[model samples]
Target: MTVGQRSGPPIPLLGVEEEFLVVDTDRGEVVPEAATVVGRARPALGTRVGGEITKLQVETRTDPCQGVDDLHGQLVEGRAAVQAAALSAGLRVIASGSPVLGRAVPPPITEGPRQDRGTATFRGLHDELAICAVHVHVEQPDRDRAVLIGNHLRQHLPALLALTANSPYWPERDTGYASWRSVTWGRWPVAGPPPFLTSARKYDEHVDMLLDAGALVDQGTIFWDLRLSTNHPTLEVRVADVPLTAAESAALAALVRALVVVAGDAVDGGDEGPELVPELLRLAYWRAARDGMGGHGVDVTTGRLLPAAALAERLVALARPALDEAGDGERVEAWLGWLAADGDGATRQRAAAALRGRLTDVVDEIVAQTAPNVPMSEESTLA
Candidate 1:
């Protein structure tokens, strides 16, 4: 069935989880100070601020929001809180997917049984796992519907990844992919594109199979590009990098919510979900990572190549009805227009590097884009 064939119900309530890399403000190197930052941020943000798997990453979540405008403001506030907290420690929070320059030695992991076990099991796999991502959660009543929506959402993941591709550098050199984080993440046992599924039962069955094979330590380790949340009644899209700024992150979240809405409408219309070759879907992910928004992308419908920007346009068109209905049509379009003219995080990072001939400049660019003009509240400011 063609995408955007029909309008969906009112936009589902959505929320965003944005992860950030903590870095030394002056030297621009990733720092293992997430605990300090999260500790400081929690006084104001409460449960909204948390530590990630690594000590260098901090994550922020906005409460479920009804509209893009509210979500955007929350995102900005969350970023500012983290920025302020990090600043208090002589550190900064940057939104790059991978650090421009990491320590010569491996970074420290957060101490937890699950995290420790994973560290023991994966060993060096977690070395480059300092990567960050922007996860968008759209509310669903149950896991079954969420799984069905995921099937419909799977085909669009690559395009979404292209639009939010922000990780272009790894350590000291460019990885030559728009999202090196996605590439590094694919090395996980349960990562990358998920199997074509028909129901929540199938999803559970697949999880059991992975568990039996020792591929996953627990159900929570199912790191598909999309999945049903273990702790919430939402379908989580974990494909995109942590965008360069709150505005871009908000726009990407809006698009994701629209996509989920459109997919749900199709399911209600009796569409079983489109099934594509698993190998081709993997290739599509690779293309999206390699080219991002500035190069060619795979047309998931036909398994053929299309320009990345055109694919993005096609995705926007597919979600137009939902966007218009949700009152986010203009804002999203304007953001897309800006993305086209200025490029995505990868493009901007490359431009910064070229202009200054230093990776530190790229970090500075990210720090500036993250939340430049927004005034921090007195509560969030450093003492």
Candidate 2:
């Protein structure tokens, strides 16, 4: 995988990891029943279903997929498996970025010795984390190239934020922001964009400093919007909130893998992009979180505000070549059209709240939307 000897075309194989909130139907709030929900689904979901740091949350991990269709189908099945399991437990799973209610309470953290130690060390910050996100992992050529991909990803981070903004309601109420999860996540000292580093050695050195300074617990806590994965040979993007629909999830996955290919090409060609200040990147992310696709976003190119929808289209254009290479261009375009018509989760949730005059209705709507299609005949196989 030498940079100079690169031949053929770039193929950034990728996969999706989605987290969901388990809610008590009677209470209309997230509940600490992930263990039950996950256990019941274990035989069906196998390794795909697991517990998150909190008992209110469960996550699904798909196998590394070489094509967008396989990745998309895996996500659909993962959601359905969890949805069916939750329903059997007299509950349901919602894909909102955070809890739907403004006055939602945090459930007890999941029972694990490691989680216990983290709670003891971080104190209240651990309690503040009831958020969930959609993480995408794209194959990398090598560790050094992975580090460069992180650098390449910074400019588009805000656009990523805008496309998948889902958390508008948090602990207090409609926070006037789209992705409250992003704001909540930023409270962590090391949880935003990665710093500028040219090589894997330098990136490792920076992470070591964060560990020594106690800014992070370990490599797992790097929490950068994008980073070289610790456990996999993929560069992972952790910036997006959990999108509600299969269309939205697949769109993000397609865009991310294409962007990785775009970056790999740039690195091989010896092209260097501008070094943006971390503060500016933070401001861009904040703007996207505040507006979703309902308003303006800070343009990463000129530091000026642009309509979020327009910027999102531009982002898709930038990655079109890579999307075409992966045979995902038509699908991504269809997703964009659907988003233009129906809006994102944040928009839909707010609309539901407004129409029914209660967040409870919003929760019900999310539940109904996430319902798995039962087999028409008992023998029908799922996708």
Candidate 3:
């Protein structure tokens, strides 16, 4: 189970946490059924399956994995477990960033004092809080080094976001943007890319400032796209939307871990990394959210537009060394080839909607793709 720091070579270990939307197949929409699904899944998955901020969402976490193959198996198994639990309740799970179909109202938040406080403070913002994401945790024992590594990550966040843009719809219609989830998530006061921090001291200072100003509920409220994990000895990247399939999620995790390794190396060599203009970084994220891999993205370095796919390829090149170090180079390259041909989740979702001419078809596609190996009865697919 222990992944990082082995004798042969110190390959950085990584873990993935993926969130899913609980959907009612008959209604073809997300439903407030996470508690029920989690209850059923817990007996089988133990700590691996759990509820999230909204009752319509469930999440799975993998133990630290030494390589992508182990991580992919866990991701697939987690999806299968959640699917089994949802089917028991006549519900299905979809991996879309946003619900393809929903009622006019927001799904209810899970009841708790912490959840209640968030609801009270954020108010209407919580109405669209049913989005899900894929969070990758890479081993980083030194907090100061992790903070510096975050700076190295900021430039690449947009490319990462574009490749995993699964939420092209909201409620009942296409949102035009690929990752509506990113746009929706950025509404929070403390969300988006972390700012440049010189050291762990600066990182704590920033968190303390937010807490003192009530901009955050607690340290847990620091929802930066990348940050030093409060509960794990890892640097967490929360930038990607929940990918359409577990394979994509695993591939995304491998790329993230590679990038983190690259960043950590740069940090150790005393590379200050680029202190990008904050506006540029924000603009870059917006471009990725809007386009995914189907359009152009902003290159922070040159301040010029490039195809998002090109940017993503460049990112793979940047992480190639680290990828090879962990024996993931070929796997990551294969994923890139798959993405180039089949397109990202956003593209696939839109394609399904176009071909089937119904939002329900989009839901069905997500469900089937999420756990293709699991057999679903007629009732599980939308009629």
Candidate 4:
């Protein structure tokens, strides 16, 4: 393929999995209507739609696409289908870090003996989990490459979290953290940054340990923020919240695919990914979770703190070559600028709530932004 036409890593296809909360539009409260919404969406979405652990949320994933533009289209289609299906059920689908205007009570559990077992095992832990996120899956050349990509991805994953932070309000008040979902996910037994490991075998051993110790209910519960896809030949990035707009979601998916390409290239060139201390990684995660793109970010490379805008630009610079290979360098930069100026979903939510003096206004704004995206910034393109 020509330089301008080449896609990422020999046409490595990527897909997006997004989770959304089903809310009663009138009352602006999360409703346990996921099963019904997923059912209503079934004829169009088929198995693409699934219920989460709780019935207040539904998950939708796009089919793998080789092009970034194609991935964006797939994401938009998925969101539109979800919105239409949800509207038919007298509800609206809101894609936020957490459902802002509702209590934390567990909704109905999704039907399945396995799901039942999970709830039965974890009880309150599983029951209280209702956060939604957008997971990007980038095709891996093999298991070994997947592990290395996960390691390489570790340094940059917090930047991903910073850009997509959407859950600012939850648990009955403003949490003051950007991606409260990250905080909530940290409560899980096996979640957050991956440990330093060079090979896929070691990765498997770690997962096996978690399963044996019952820290994980099964392979699906591995929950390593970023992980090797258990079923597909892809490295899955699970750090981002379910963004409020199709554009934000598309921006994140493109960056993830670019990072996957960059990481794969590093592995091919026999480069070892960085080995930062887990404590540093934890602090970085905490900083990003607290501030989103509105505050300083921990520079994982040098341990120096940088403004979120500079850090975001550094990430784009690091991934520029891969982004060029994927034909999305310009698109990513444009959207990155937008995210910097506009702030993440969490910032937007807080602003809306502050203006309208009600959390329900924030919910309404989220639902509207989910469709026909309200531009986050006037400066969409960056030089």
Tell me the whole-model lDDT of each prediction, alpha carbons only: 0.86, 0.81, 0.88, 0.82
**Candidate 4 Cα lDDT to native:** 0.82
lDDT of 2 by residue, 66-185 (tens): 777888888888888888888777777888898875334555787777777677667778866788899999888588877877788898998898889999888537888889999989
Clashing residue pairs, candidate 3?
none
RMSD of each: 4.0, 4.2, 1.8, 5.0
Give the poorly placed runs of model 4, Cα more than 4 Å off. 1-11, 373-383
Relative to the unseen true structure, what is the C-alpha lDDT of residue 46 in candidate 2, on a scale of 0 to 100? 97
Error of 1 at 237 (Å): 0.2
Report the number of the highest-TM-score candidate: 3
lDDT by residue (tens digit), candidate 1, 1-383: 11223344456788999999998866788889999999999987999999998898999999998878888999999998998888887788889898897682377888989998787777888787789999999988667777888888899999899999999998889989999889999998888778788889998999999989877778888888898888888899999999998998889988888888888888888886889888778889999999898999998778899999888888999999788777778878988898889998899999999985988778877888887864433333222
Query: Candidate 2, 66: how far from true, in Å?
Result: 1.2
TM-score result, candidate 3: 0.97
- Per-residue lDDT tens digits for candidate 3, residues 1-383, read 33344333266788999999998979778889999999999988899999999998999999888778999999999999999988888899989888889862577888999988888778898899889999999988888888888999999999999999999998998889999999998999889998888999999999999989888877998899998999999999999999988888888898998888787777778896789988888899999999998899999887899998889889999998878777778888887887889888999999998986988889899999998888998767687
Ranking by lDDT: 3, 1, 4, 2
Least accurate 10 contiguous residues by lDDT in model 3? 1-10
The residue-level lDDT of candidate 2 at 365 comes to 68
Candidate with the larger lDDT of 3 and 4: 3
lDDT score, candidate 2, position 320: 90
Higher-lDDT candidate of 2 and 3: 3
- Candidate 2 local Cα displacement, residue 326, angstroms: 1.3
Whose lDDT is greatest here? 3
Off by over 4 Å in 1: 1-10, 374-383
What would the per-residue lDDT of candidate 4 be over residues 177-265, giving only the tens digit for each residue? 99988998898888898887889999999999988888877888888889988888888999999999887788788888888777888
